[model samples]
Target: MNLSVSLASGEPIYQQIKEQIKRQILSGELREGELLPSIRHLAADLNISVITTKRAYDELEQEGLVASVAGKGTFVTEKNKEAIREVKLRQLEEQVRSLAAESRMLGLSKQDVIGLFDLFFGEGRH
Candidate 1:
């Protein structure tokens, strides 16, 4: 899986790693049973500590998104479709909440938000 970290993003490095990996799994970019990079190797590649990568993988395991095979590396797990859907829905809800707050700060109405959304959502359709 492709991953990157941004020190300026204000999120912890492990969280950035965990979230990208989760998104890849949820979107099927990382398939079930695909082996993730070894912790040390990934850490070296990202120029971060192995401990950070291990923590990210641990969080993923706790979320049931990946499994460790002892001697082997971590791999993606077969997910429950409903659970993935719920996760995505929650993410969308959070994005909408942020958008709503930002729009209110800019004095934009609900209709204004909908109009902007429609404009962007339809940009590629046409």
Candidate 2:
């Protein structure tokens, strides 16, 4: 697992690490059943505190993305494609809801937001 913590980012370092690792897992870059580096090793690699790495791993475990075995190490959990898709869909929906709220706060109509989305994504499709 590769992670680069952005100290300049407003997000907590552990959250940044957790998000990157989660993205890797979702993208299939980090295969299921693959062992992740030890928390100490990962902390040293990222030049962060062990507590930060532990927090990231704890969140992953809570999300069922990784499992830890006593005396062994943390490993990615095997997930069905449908299950992964559902998880991703839920996450996306939450983000979309937040964005919609922000748009509403900015006085953007639903149609205007849809148009902006189409313009932004449609351009990339072609």
Candidate 3:
């Protein structure tokens, strides 16, 4: 599990860890049943406290993104596609909201925004 935290990002280290792991799971980089690195190992590798790492893992577990075994370790759970889709959709919606606000401030019309969106995606550009 490759992860990093930036002290300057203004987010808590545990939240950073949780978000990174969630991204990996959602992106399918970490498959279901794949064992995560031990908490102690991850803490050592990241130079973070074991408590921080455990908190991240615990949140992920509570969110149904992972499961912890008593004798083994944490493992990614079978992802719920609807849940994943909802997450991505919410992010996109927020982006659109910001775009709409900025567009209105710039005196751009709805058609103008649509044209730009079409121009970008219609040309196969991400």
lDDT of each: 0.94, 0.92, 0.93
Candidate 2 per-residue lDDT over residues 33-123, each given as its tens digit: 9999999999999899999999999999988899999999999999767868987999999999999999999999999999999889867
Q: Which of 2 and 3 is ahead in TM-score? A: 3
Instruction: Give lDDT: candidate 3, residue 80.
Output: 81
Candidate with maximal TM-score = 3
Model 2 spans > 4 angstroms off: 80-83, 98-126
Better of 1 and 2 by lDDT: 1
Per-residue CA lDDT of candidate 3, range 57-90, in tens? Answer: 9999998899999999999988888877887898
| TM-score for each predicted model, relative to the true structure | 0.83, 0.76, 0.86
Model 3 lDDT at residue 34: 99
**Per-residue alpha-carbon lDDT of candidate 1 for residues 1-126, written as tens digits (9 for 90 to 100):** 689999999999999999999999998999999999999999999999999999999999998899999999899988878878888899999999999999999999999999999889977674
Superposition TM-score, candidate 3 onto the true structure: 0.86
